[model samples]
Target: MSENNCIQYINCHCYMTIQSLQIKARMFSRISLISLIMIPVIWSQDWQVQYSSMMKCALKGSNTHLSGSYKHPNHLTMIKTFWIVNPVKGEETINLVDHPDYKGRVQYSQNKDGIFFLSLSNVTHKDEGMYCLRIVAKEDKYLFFPGIDLKVTELRVEIPEEAVEGKSSILFCKTTCHLSDKTNFTWFKNSKRLSESNVSDQLLLPSVSTDDTGNYSCAVTDHKHLSSPAVTLSVRYPPKSVSVSISPSEIVEGDSVTLICSSDSNPPALNFSWFKENQSSAVGCGQSFIISSFNSSHSGRYYCEAQNKYGSQRSASVSLTSAGDQKAVLYAAAAIGAMLICICIFIVVKKNIRKTGDAGGQSGVSKQEENNSTAVTDQTSAKPPKPADLNESVYASITHSRPREQQRDGDEDEVQYATVQHHRNTRNTTAEDGCQNGNSVSAGSNTEKADDSNVIYSSIKSS
Candidate 1:
């Protein structure tokens, strides 16, 4: 036949074979419209005779009833039969049992019922795939049944390695499906289930701490199925018991101050820094910090911070002012200035009194001297051309009482003359004419003489 006629013939044969198999399948089993079908129909005509053989078989579950069909126009005989499995698309291919004795052979059987027994132990996921029942006859073809789909359930959990103390933390356990649907969920801490509610997707520790640290796992089961790969939760925080204080609760200019930062932490702080308001400055990791000569520049809202492997924490800010020193200095200066002024005033008053006293004393001395000189002149004039003896007698008594009486006398001539006579007589008279003769002078004369001398001397001194 021509190529076209031959192609038409093969097509006709394949269509008739499929139609016959469908009719037979309908009569044998009650299948749904969506049920898959596999049929064997040969297209080549190489005229050969072979024995039928079973090459591979894949059965799902415990049911080993394998059902498929193949057709051949030529006579064939049954030979050795062996089981094998089809290769998967994305996984490694395993070599199933092969039957060399049944190679290039065909199979013929009177048993039309499609059922075969297979070992249940040999059934596995790797054995799952499209399986074929090969029949070597006048034409070689295969009866195929698509492999069954296998599903696996795995349990997975996610949680943070570290958590802040006293903070609510969540431990999540996720699965392919809801635990209530087909599986039971059991949360474990150190291998103890903590499932009390329907919430199996998460395990909650309202407040977490280092004491809560341990290996955590979820026991997820679907009937007899179980999963592995538990999770570990390491509850940790940056630190606790953070504290801060300011040295010299009172601050002043030109004074050294410090800020102390301390805390209880594991994996001690690595970065210690200071901040004023929002501005940050690098600092050493110490409990106390010293800032020499604190000033207004150092005055502001101050704070400290500590950091560790977990995280960082900041202390409350303390406000500082450096105006104290300025105020103190101003007060001291005012006090000193007042003291100095008082000292100066005292010194001035004392000096003025001494000068006044000295002037008064000098004036008095000069007045006395003048009075004595004036008295001498007067006495010399009054004595006249009398005898030196008489003059001496009068002057002698005058000189004796003049010193006592001169200060009381107010007359200038009498006092001056008497003073002169007194000096002359003291020089002229001898001590032998003492009391008796001196008393002979008049009391009025003596008194008047002394008063005049005092007045003249005082007047001259005053001028």
Candidate 2:
């Protein structure tokens, strides 16, 4: 009776066990699927503060706004909310508004949308750091780690230490943080727009020159109002526009003269040399060249050379004349005038002389040259003038002798005299000097003569 019952029971029990195993496996699969879906929902609902931007680049000296939204378990009530920087004080939540560094510069605000905001004015380099939001609740306080990385920066112009003409140089527009690669830069020089290229953060100068010297600044294209301070850029160059200046416009012999050298360059040309035209050597070296006593030696075309570390330049020449040259011209004129005066005097004296015919009074005649003859004809038959008459007459006399080769020691010398010019007929009148060897006076005739007076006689020296 027990064997049939035992076998049936064992068969029913094995079937039941197999059915239970399949149902349990199905239930376990359902539970795992539910857990996988529910875990993310629970994690998403955990206490978390998320900012609008994970990283921000704010312009210095400008105001910036940062917003954050938070979610937590509904059972917890928020008691306070605040902002702070990294290296936070764990025990003391330092109030940003009360911080000496942030006082008067930080503001806290909230909106009906449950969005919390932090407004910072007059941002500065000191404000650059990681920022976090703290939510204080009745049961606990929460801080979101790996918070906002804020960068407060301004444009800055960085140039090569030495800027030289005719050389390449690069100027950088820099910021505290690296901006987006697509960000464009603007440049200004002397308060005017300098570069038109907007893709590069650097200004490239293929060749530097004095024209590039000026106050330079840079800015981001989007934040033009947040530009950097102007920096002076000096481009060095050699001396140029060299020129010479004279103190006195007029120059003369024995007068002092000064020559000045000047030029245009990045650095002033300190070394100056003066040279004369057609001369290779320098006459002097200095900004000024002085000739204490001007003379012919100093009269010439002069120029100056200005030199600096970069290069040298020569100035246009200026010419000068000595007064001695003027004096020489004056002397030549005086000599020519004297010679003309002597010639005029000799012509007058020769015209006044009368030529007597011979020593013997045989129809004695005075031979004389004439343009218009004023000669008195000799009257051989007329009586001679009285000695008293001769004494009152104006007359001049000169001694004439033959050439030394023909003259004997005892030979009589001929005497020529100039008589007063008058309208009259008169015999030969011979006036003899002490050297005349007994020349006879004219015993010849004389006609009634007009008063012989007021005749201007000129002297003729023997040639």
Candidate 3:
């Protein structure tokens, strides 16, 4: 037959087979019968089977069961069954009774309903294949079921022995089972999904770096089925992202400051060197540089270099200055000193002025008291003061002494009188002693009156 005619005949046959299977489907709800009828049409029409493959995922060294079915309606009993394996060598057929290749490791059985299955024990990489069942009816008719692709994937991640930064590296999602380019693959790094479902089995890192270094794994697109355990990927590179830090961001004079250096590298930064701006050589070494006492000498722009076996990197400059509080404190102290001095000067000046006023007031009071005493003395003595001392004016005068009055008798008609000086320094004046006949005669205490001018007329009696 011509190719076109053969194709047309195959199509016609497939249509008739589908119609027959559909008519019988109402009699039986079993899905195996319908699939068996359509398997031939599917195989002939499409070289690339569009139907999803029956996936049987098993771990290495585990037992698995692969199911296949071929059922027919009345007057059709299964006479013989065979299994076909598509392996690397080619397509192979194994009889259920005595298969030499899988002698004791495999068991095959068919139930009364015409469903067939096989159990593979201690499955290994070599046993992975596309399996199908071929059924022979008692009427000598034959049927083939669609394949149950047994994928005994020993899922694992393949990593390069050495990965360098800024270089390309590839990670492979390895499996012993045959996988096509259309198979969906999932990649994970550090348990995080790297990308959505992809068709490529290999994950490419255009430039492997520290960011790409992590635990990696792969899985089939179906989340229910996973491929491999995670493996680690390490990338080696020079020290990078160098940084410098101060323990206390604010620095102060007389305070100890700690300088820390850090960098990101695969082998880690093995050496650290500290440098100051405008300096020709490194000032310090190690991961940390300590200043026992910070000062202007320690204040400058500083940076650090981190080195490893690969290379070195320098950090950006960081500036350090004395804490502002120091200047503030100084200013405060100076101000306080000035204020204290001012206050002290004010108090001292006030005390001196008070002393001077007290002295002047006491001197004036002494002079006034002296004048008052002289005036009191002059007035009490009933004498005028000296012209140089004070001018005295008599408002009222007090008598120093008083004498008693007495009555004179006619027989003794002589009056006695005495003269006295008011002050011890004053001269006494004698009163004129005058006496007349028929008048009273004045008599002195010590001497008798003589005449009118020299002795007063005495009172003479008739006797």
lDDT of 1 by residue, 1-463 (tens): 8999999989999999999999989866545322323223222232221212223332222112333333334454544332334544465333233334323322223355433322323233443444444343333333233332222234667886567777888877665423234435667677665655743666788898788888877655322123346677766678566667877887778889888888767667766777678665554446677888987777667777888888888787777777685577779999999999999999999999987986687578667766886788788778653444443323322322233234544644333232322322333443334344674333344332333332211211212
Q: Lowest lDDT 10-mer window, candidate 1?
A: 454-463
Runs in model 1 lying further than 4 Å from the true structure: 1-84, 87-144, 151-154, 160-170, 174-180, 196-201, 205-211, 222-227, 236-238, 243-463
What pairs collide in candidate 2? 382-445, 383-445, 383-446
Report the Cα lDDT for candidate 2.
Answer: 0.73
- Sorting all predicted structures by lDDT, with the top scorer first, yields 2, 3, 1
| Count of steric clashes across candidates, in order | 21, 3, 9
Tell me the whole-model lDDT of each prediction, alpha carbons only: 0.54, 0.73, 0.67
Q: Which tens-of-lDDT digit does each residue in 1-463 have in candidate 3?
A: 8999999999999999999999898657545545433633333212112213466666566667776654345566757776666623344455634666667887887678545668787777777677766556677634354466677666789999988998999999887666545667788877878767454778989987778889988876643145589999999999988998897887878899999999988889889999999999999999999999998877788999999888899999998788875577679999999999999999999999987996687567657656765787777688644443221122222222111123222443344333321211112222211211242222333333222333222322211
Q: In terms of TM-score, which candidate is stronger, 2 or 3?
A: 2
Per-residue error (Å), model 3, residue 188: 3.2
lDDT of 2 by residue, 258-375 (tens): 9999899868899999999898799999999999998888778999999999899999998777656756777999999999999999987776552222232222222232211232
RMSD of 2: 21.0
Those runs of model 3 whose alpha carbons end farther than 4 Å from true positions after fitting are 1-153, 162-165, 176-184, 190-197, 209-214, 221-224, 234-241, 247-255, 293-296, 321-463
